[model samples]
Target: MQIDFSRSIVDIVLDHGNSIPDRTALIFDQGDGAQSSLTYAELATRITQLAGALSARGLAGRRIALLFSAGTDFALALLACLAAGGVAIPLAPVGRRKARLQNILNMLGDIRPDCILLDDSMAALFGDELSAALAVGPVRYLEFAALAAEPHPFAALTLRPDQLAVLQFTSGTTSNPKGVMISHGNIIANEAMIQVAFGHDQDSHFVGWVPHYHDQGLFGNILQPLFLGSTCVITSPAAFINRPMFWLQLITRYGAHTSGGPNFGYDLCVDFATRRGMPDDLDLSGWRVAFNGAERVRPGTLDRFAECFADAGFDRRAFLPCYGLAESTLVTIAVPPQSDPIVKSYDSRALAAGRAEESKDREGVLELACCGPAMAGAEARIVDPATGAALPDGAVGEIWLRGPHITAGYIDNPAATEASFGRLDEGAPFLRTGDLGFAAAEGFFIVSRLKDLIIVRGRNHAPSDVEQIWSELSGTVGQASAAAVEIEMGDTQHIVLIAEMKRDDARALSDEKVQEMAGRLRAMAMERLELAVTDLVLVSASTIPRTTSGKVQRKQAGRMLMDGELTVLAMAGPLAQAFGPSEQGASAAGQSALR
Candidate 1:
């Protein structure tokens, strides 16, 4: 169970390649019926060749940016960087759009990488534009074919565990992304932790469609399998988006023991199964440790998914709710393997006041699923965000983390790093997670982000609680909904609800019907959560802004609502009806709810 922290990841790969040269290391199912396989020896040779090529170009101890569009090329490029003693920086692929192109350029500016790896296909896709942009920069661009240019002596390369391995960029949902510096030691520790938590052995298999750019994709889909010396079936992110069922089918086909994504993925599967129905002859008895993380884990989604797939041999207990961030090297806490995820409801008002009192009233409560306890090498604690004081169990506060899995710090941002890494007791290095949660007898329960919590009359309310209220309308709520603070009528902030309409129903329903539905939603919010809704906007799908990983960007949606960027299909209630200038126009009861 102990990971040799003194050894680099490459050492593990070498041992596997030498011990099981003929064993399958990776299986690529492009989701188009095209498949490819790589053995341990074959993959090791390719990685060593590419590493040698990178070393020939003076990339050793320097940063190497990977710009491939996923598949064998992407995986090999990452391994090559580590093998060649270069820090790996996986970048978003180049696109013609000005914004995406600028993002790549901005990343390049920050990393100033010695070389950038571009697969043959992507090199041809961008052609002149990509070549011209790189021509002005000092960095070198190497094609995938260049990996064959006289395989250098990888055996002579020196590898260090404390050296930089990866620069994982934080998900830029709330702010501009910053690169987190992950040392080789961090990767080794986290990978071992994951192997233990998920029970991944050499015989275990993995199937996932997560994009290689995200932390979940890199750590959960790619690195963990390699660390475990197991076979992993790969597919593109577009594949899952195009057909959510294909992800599960791949698991069934490959007899994969582990596969999962964010809570939204499970919801997507349930939605698709409802419309398309489960495929005939599908079997999932072998599937285990269905991890749910990188976002809030919804218990309702878990229940719906289990019920929907129960006929296909799916087990509800396979659902493993977890909590993690890129800063902690992917996973900090995960539900122990083979255990059913725990869900509990708390008094909504008491939760707002930073207490975890069990709800007595069934109608007005906030339900949250536990992400389980801290991982093997890590410790998690709740602390007061304002005073850095440790909070007792059953009290909500910011979650602080300390472990070998934790990153060194943010790259080139001393002030931000210093502000993020604060001490709790006896000067222990704890990374301030900026997440609001509470620890109880069961485990850690994530309530919401500290910055994202909505405050009205000094009581904090989770936006998810309000969003879930509207989403309960089921047929009316589409793919996503957002509740945000709308600062209106001179500094007074009221909760603004923006929902996406189902595309099919939006086309058939009249404006009157939409307005009636919104009225119902407004009434339900008032009755259930004891909150007054100022304005409700029902717009078409894609109206509510979301991050690349499908998380609702509440701040961005709020900004879009204020700027009139979203196409408003229907609107209900006055924008400032809750706090209008004329006291006669406002309801006395609604005013009391606001207070």
Candidate 2:
């Protein structure tokens, strides 16, 4: 069924809000450790009030920036913006708010948002620290608390289905960020896809500590729950990052039956569980659909997560492997929850060579896990990344997808937009995802992120290849790690390995001792992988600024290092003197253009 998104997302919310006024629509944790509840009626009222405030400021049909941390206000404000027929751009509210703020400002200069909405405290912070956040000049601005205080007023704002809803910016590999313009129709399509994929109903409840700014966090945790009239338990991403196991514990505590995250989340669960172990009385029987999406789903991580949580009533069948990206709003495919999660293993060489070769994954060790077929309207295909020729089954190539949920194009970037949308060859056009993968009857295998691939000396080396070696080190690092990548001098690729002690103590930084650890990593790369490293940057466990979804922004990490903010620099004694010869050094790295 086609949707008339002309009514805007607010219309959908009002429909459900009126019908489910009594339902526990939103359960949020007040940062101070207290819990707060907002029913459908209450949230709708908040949206109306916020929308009225925004309307008073003439924000309709204009682009608006939201700089927020997390919690109830963030959700309501986003929905309110949708209702007001404004294009919402949610940005990271952490870090030197100025740096991210300036980045957002630069983007707005291109798209030209009319107003910027920021945290009540952050607005004050910028007002006091204006010089620090120098990019502020044009555009109106509003603080969070101020908008909340405005009176509620009914407004009839219509939005076409294809009208831009949000500008979700994804970081470029070596360039500035690009914003994907998600439409109202795409939002509807993805919500329906997620609703169908999860096989849930109004009775379903979703709980999460995922960031509201991320596509997965916003789609799975906020939009899906609110759109379906399901109960949602929300918490700060910081709370979860600080304690990842709380994601699992929350499922048991609130009887939330629907949830998912990236592979690292499950791995973290295993890492935490093995060291701390699950609570003896933990009950995860209520979890009906525990899915993993938004990032590469590793098979080993899934297997170990099952092993660690087996005693806590966690069922392997509850895990559902899936695939998605911001271009699709959120979901593209999701396997139905099963009793025993299955992973299809293929010989690594055969996969890279664009052919199928079955392999035995050590009796119990998990190998490959394929994301299922396109959900609902989406169509998935494999095309050679370079030639744009469609590949047959069992052949590896770039993954191309198109459906109702696919974004129209990147905001304000016609070149990138046209280039990314479709490729023409032999009179056929297809969206080139840049991702390399292939289909295998039941589902598709996603090899890796296209942008993250490293082309060193003509050989493609996945950063994960080396990072895995460090991550798997015995009795050290654990899961608390950060891998920032930068091209060194002379066009040589350099990876800065950063890991803080699990105990989170600065005294743990014994230079010579950590150098000894770096030596172990250097040996693995040189002898086993034939790679040279320039430096190792070690920081406290939380120094690395991730996307709250565990995605390491290498550029951000490099900036931290260049600014002399790094905590520890561990360089292999050999390359320490050969920095001038590295390709990423001096002029080579700075002059090289991004592909």
By lDDT, the best candidate is 1
lDDT of 2: 0.70
When summed lDDT is taken over every stretch of 10 residues in candidate 2, the lowest stretch is 580-589
Residues 1-595, model 1: lDDT tens digits = 4667876777787678899889888888966878888888988888888787777777877888888786877888898889888899988662345666677767888878887778777677654566678897788767777666666776546677678899998876676778899999989999999988877899888997877878898988988888878898889887887798889889989999999888878877888888888789789888888999888888788888888998899998898888999899899988888888899988887888889988757776777899999988789999999999999999999999998888878999999899888888775589998899999987899998787777877877777777777767754322355554544444555567777765575657775776777677767766666666677666667667666566777877766655556665555666534333321223343344334
lDDT tens digits, residue span 344-412, model 2: 766554554556667675321215677787887678888877777778888877889877888887876
Off by over 4 Å in 1: 94-98, 148-150, 476-485, 502-508, 576-595
What's the lDDT for residue 110 in model 1?
A: 82
Model 2 TM-score? 0.85
Lowest-lDDT window of 10 residues in candidate 1? 578-587
C-alpha TM-score for every candidate: 0.93, 0.85
The C-alpha stretches of model 2 lying farther than 4 A from their native spots are 1-7, 30-33, 97-111, 130-136, 171-175, 361-366, 424-429, 456-459, 474-548, 554-568, 579-595
- The Cα error of candidate 2 at residue 224, in Å, is 0.2
The global C-alpha lDDT for each of the candidates, from Candidate 1 onward, is 0.79, 0.70
